[model samples]
Target: MKSSYTVENPDYQLSPKTGMTRSHYIELAKYLLEGAFQHIDSFDDILTFPLIDGKTYPQEDSPAWRFRSLEFEALERTFTLAAPLIHNDPETEIKGINLRDYYANLLYKALTPGNPNSLPMPEDLPDSTYQYTCEFGGLFKTLLLMPDTIWSVYTEEQKAAMVKTISAWGHHRTTQNNWRIFNITTLSFLKKQGYEIDDGLLLNHLQWVVSYHSGDGWYLEQTYNYYSISLFIVYTTIWNRGFGDEYYPEISKTIEKSAQKLMESIGNFFGRDGYINMWSRSICYRTWVSGAFPVAFMLENPNLLDGGWARRLCSGSLLQFVTKEEFFVNGIPSLGFYGQKDYMVQSYSCPASPFLMFLPFICLALPEDSPFWTETENDGFWEDLGDASTQTLLPSPGLMLVNHGKTGTSEIIPGKVYYDDPNYSKLTFNTHFPWEDQNPDGGTSMEYAFRSLDPRDLRGDDINFYLTGKTVDNDSELRAKFTHSQNMLFNGQRDGVLYRQAIMRQPPNNGVGYIIDLAEITLPGGVLRVDRTRLAFEYELTLGHFGLPHIDGVEATVEERKLADRTVMIARIPGRSLAFITYHGWDQAEAMTHDGNNAEADSSTVLFARKTAPKVNPKMEILITAMLHKMDDSEWTEEELSPVKDFTIQTFAPSGSPCGVQVNLSSGASHHVDYQNIDGLRTC
Candidate 1:
């Protein structure tokens, strides 16, 4: 029963340690080099054609060429010039050294001295091409950091020129994800090369990064499903090198702690089938969860208690990804889950973006003696327990997950869009100013984050899943308290946090409610509850992607279904319906009727009303129902209940010491739920 119903995976040929016998590290290295060579002259071609004559360049051809030629050329030069340094001199002396430099030299000669069409361009280009250029910069930075190379064959003046070129362009840009990552990475490269740049400007850039930390390991991906954890882990790693445990030890420690929190997030994110929630913008940049490798590898200190466990937690997910061929597209890694079609790309991703997955190769950078390089793979977070595995429920947040066999969770379908845009997956909610809930209290706001952790792996004990989440509170220190039967833990810090826990699925037909209550929280002026629903949209529509309806003259209905000690209020309409109730300030937000038809309307449950039924005079009927409750400036509590659980309660939370968590469950009797098979997906 467990084998058939459990979320287990089939092995693939990728990882060296498990599944497929292929050496993926070597394949990935070839892929990265091929990507660099394949696009060597792409910028040059883009610069030669402007498309201003009103010619529509197919996606294979970028028309923004004329406007961004110089920027592209500079970026290309960054990569072209750094390639030679990858294999030679000191680096080649190290173990496992190989160099592929012909493409690098060809690309370098083509872009150096700066193509007139492509020099001195704004570090910021059209939104359409910015990510491509930045990624070019990232690749170049990675090449520069390689331990050896032919770069030393160049005169001092030439190497300095390269450093100056990178510094100038990287410093001028300013966007959260791009700038923060670019700055830290570039700064690390510069410091390594022994070049001097302004300390104040560099630190200021770091400070700006510090400001974006949202306490619980969240950094705004920006405007939409901005991925915070992946970006932060990478940026913090670069920053860690530059800081050297000096000025910002606390901040560094906080980031390390937050990285653990991020692992907890990844642990809950994957389902038993090795599936991951594909909810953010760079769906094409799918292997992003693996990007956390550098951060995890950095926490070598066992004294930090959870530090060692955190590394293993994150490494386990990475191992899960590489076991499958899902991480690559046409031999080159794609942007994410849906490949370039992923909604998060928003034109930011280019052919160069997925190479960022090489960010995980930072693991290779671990010295030969490092533990991560030698640790053996296990069943990971999904280890089998004595009886039935763990399960968790989050009702108000609209998420029901079950962890089978091990402490990890699972999802029936992985990477299915929870909203139209991957960005919407981070549903930061508020209770005040309903109309401005996402931006409550003017600028201060709250948001939720979800990530699918199944990297490209072929392991059988994989976790497959889709995660839907919402922020009930924007402030720090929100907690989900349960019995010793099971628990959820919380830890809040000034510079992000490390909150980790396992979420299990509730038993079938058990009306168990996992309440995620928020205290010291405020809602937007026009909102009642921020309900998040994950949907798979076959079309590309951006309007009302958050599940809010925009249909004019649409009517609504509301009803109250009572359970043992709770009342479940349901709002509906024929077929599919969406309801948006405005607070007008809580008291004023209520069920208002202006009817031409007669329908049963309950006071306790607000619903959109109509004269008759939609079957009769559907045209004249437009009823809206909203429930209201009043509260003054005093301590307040809000609770959401599930339909009901016949006879079981479960709780799980991260344990403080041996660095993990304790799982507790009470199911009345010994009969356990058994079923197996997990689900996972790969983008072809």
Candidate 2:
């Protein structure tokens, strides 16, 4: 049995790595849905959840949520969980109501006129931006993915009402990003049913999404966070499965190729044991990572993945969250990554929102003969990176994926030019160290920052990529120039080193920002960063490492090492370990603590390094820092905690950053970083 399975009675034969076979999935799905299912008393009863008054997220009565209905959110999202379950077990019953029959009847009432809980169609709603437009797409996808349970069983009148409702929602407004895919999926289903749809708009959406394709799959060019997976791939596959052949065969064929390529790259996103390195927003939708697989397998796409590897990953991710005893709250998946993690919930989340985590269950709908079920499970990248680590450079998204073999950690370093919040501008995001709890008193977010001591800066918090240097100058909406990074280059990394550059100023505006270049080398334990500062010398710089979960009644740090110009701090419990090192160009290091500020633990601790430029400042300044994560209790070796073997800076040539610098590690790995040609690079 898989050790990750915290619950008893796990099956190993079908899934040597996860014990999550077709039948196992059926059982797991029932357990998960039971939370919402137990409250059902009749075929037409809407699933209602009690609100915690002012504590309600998205604020129940706020103007932003004027178009949102708690009842509709609770009912529709729960059906997302029930759709696949009923596909495999059509006769499933809950609280004396047939799961399939309840949804079909409830939806019919919701779409028909005069019902108390009837959903307002797109035109009738206050505006086209109604939440119902985003929420109703799943109903159409469910009807298409498994028609017998809802669509086929419906009467002619019931079918017409739902279709008309979907058709209206199809024409509603959409966010420029992934929301457009929802319209495509729901409208494609209507088109497949021989109904009329604006083919121009439909084709337009397909073309628009295809335009995002940045090569090597994932449409990876700058697609942020869960937008790449949950919405884009999920609905695209649903549209492809239901109508791609007859509607747009050429684009469908291209999507198939892209999906296959995406599968290979996404495989690295998960560790050997299957914990997905999650970053960015939508932290509540934990299992959506598994959405990548089943659709490809259902279509029988070849060369997509090793069947054993796919299930192992799907199962691994499921076990990580589902096995936690605290995963549920009040009989449903909590609005947090784990149980009641207030720090993990987004402001936009509603109570029943987490029910959309039904992707992994799609495997249950696959036939028994599929390789996804027959193949023996095996480790994905662990088979290759036994004791080493490597990084994948995705040029379009300007992303680097690091696979840490010894400790089962996945780290992503993305080249971000502009950001609205800290979530987007962090130097890196790691699966092991999830973005820390965003509390005021909590340790700060992981970033390479310039804490503005100058009262001139309008914003108070430490500067991220956008340095608000010489603050208080432009009072026009607290102006800070974008760190435009169109020049995110890969000129280095000939030997495991990553070199890149980004201009930090808004040209044409004549803003005062730097043309900064950054370089990194991924070691087995952590990443070594070489950051150059061209900002004015008065601003003090601070580097914040990933926050470590702190245990109550225990010391925040297990051990710490301090040198004249270097220091290392380590924190760990039984299962997770974290290390932070300030190697060079820093004056002081301190570990800060906060209460109830972590998603995974009760408290969190972070090592923050601070330094100001020397009195005799040069045109360019450099800082080096490293962070490591592990899953074991062993102490770090000297080599693992040692400073860089060598670092060279030219005394002459005397321009901004040295034209080229060589930094080496004890392992004989060397990085030749050159910024001489940065002037010729592209500007964003």
Candidate 3:
């Protein structure tokens, strides 16, 4: 874990939140780049390393194989190290390699037609357009951001050859996602260089991608992940600073407004401690979770980080990952998020996958006197809101984030459903406790499981989760042309409580769709879950509390307290405690232990509550309150567990079924939920 380069002195005055400064960033860049630099024998060698699992793609060397693209990931991502270093100080060197000279030589070698590491053209691999064009943005952005370092040093012939390779990706069929930005950025760079491209096509793509701006702040992607900030907003801001106004000013206006709005609330998503609400995929790009900070600082006025907040985030985000010895395997950042967690790894990820995270270092390209550097860091909302949580509802993507004041962690409630993986499908994702991987029983933290009708096994997303989903903002028509397996019927916040109403059709039994409403109100320790279940038939249901990372072999104590009205299940270790109270429905409680599945620890204990039956009523209310805490409080108070001092149910039927309901919590929070319009809910 010893770094080859180290930040010498601490700057607590400049950065109170994280103690990271300009020097820290430089040394950190050198430290990270050293991993790749050590493995590089010369500029001609491809930038890649062994996958942590030591597995190979099933289609290696075939046209479908993404091996070439994986190699490109290595080359373009490592450029992030040299990009700012060479620009900020051209004499930069790491591990005896002249950073500027090496990257300059690399640019030429990788762009020329015959180099081993050179990216394959679109025509060469017609099936995988993502491979042909995905990395060009990283390549061109470095050139554009600091021309003197790499691009300016190149000979005219070297530049021309690179352009030929760049220009060869004129336009082609691909997933209707971020590639629009990639294509547009490439075209904009070419046009800036006085090369000819289809202006109409560029404008068309420009207008098309602008529609992806979710009015609240996010630019939606297929996965609806962190790329919204790191890739979508970053590339959009870059293009706008370069060519947006000249090409299509009207669309540029809309883009600017969304970007500005994004800057306003983007930082709120990050905890006071600076950990981003890590709710979605590609967690391998660890620190890039806050990758939007650099772009916000790079932008002009209305980019809105109150006072030198970007540096606080940048520094904290970098430390959150790099400081962890487990974050690196051998030397490079691991292919997984926190450590070498197999659950977080996807087939597409490689050792270089984490390299894409280097985008945050682009802050190094900024001038010293810029506000991002000179001003003292401040904790924006954490300083303002004392002991309270902030629940920001983003309707465009059905994402609701609750920033806890005491825990210094963020919990996200997402509306979209991805049955294939808990990464996206989980009802809740906590910053401190991330999603558990490779859970065979489907009883993962912050997720649900239903016993199979066959009674042979536990069933999860594979049987019931949506194959794909998206919000309406993702499509240009105000509604997309294609159909998604699932959709967000409604996403809204009522009185500090974030709620998402969604319906899922059993994939095997398409006619057997069910409506479920997920709602939660924040607590000092954890948020309380109030779920409305409406199934056509009775099914055994199980819910899990946030998985507590088992620490230092300390055995957790499990106890069940049965009060007059409800039973609370408590499990606690020294530093942390996890409790589950099944308030409304009938249930049994237990704990599941896991190993090698969590990124934060070697093993974890996830407490679960099960509803064996609920009187055979199709209309049932299930209230399971769970709290996972880090002793911000000395001990669990009796009053804290019962946040809901009162719950008033209305509209009782003679058949003993409640037609509608209302909730009044002891914390002075309330919610009015009704099934009156449940059938009328909209779907994408």
Could you tell me every candidate's TM-score relative to the true structure? 0.50, 0.88, 0.88
Residues 566-611, model 1: lDDT tens digits = 3333344433322333211111212333221111111112232111
lDDT winner, 1 or 2 = 2
Best by lDDT: 3
lDDT of 3 at 225: 72
lDDT by residue (tens digit), candidate 3, 507-614: 555333455566676776577776777655445566777776667555567778887667777877766676687677645777878777666778888887766543
* Separate clash counts for every candidate: 97, 4, 0
Q: Name the lDDT of candidate 2.
A: 0.66
Report the error of model 1 at residue 40, Å: 8.0
Query: Where's the lowest-lDDT run of ten residues in candidate 3?
Result: 475-484
User: How big is the positional error of residue 296 in model 1, measured in Å on the Cα after superposition?
Assistant: 1.2
lDDT values of the candidates?
Answer: 0.35, 0.66, 0.67
**Residue pairs with backbone overlap in model 2:** 277-431, 456-471, 456-472, 457-471
> Which stretches of model 1 miss by more than 4 angstroms?
1-24, 31-100, 103-111, 115-120, 123-129, 136-153, 191-196, 223-226, 242-254, 260-266, 271-274, 300-330, 335-344, 385-684
* C-alpha root-mean-square deviation, candidate 2: 4.6
Error of 2 at 14 (Å): 3.1
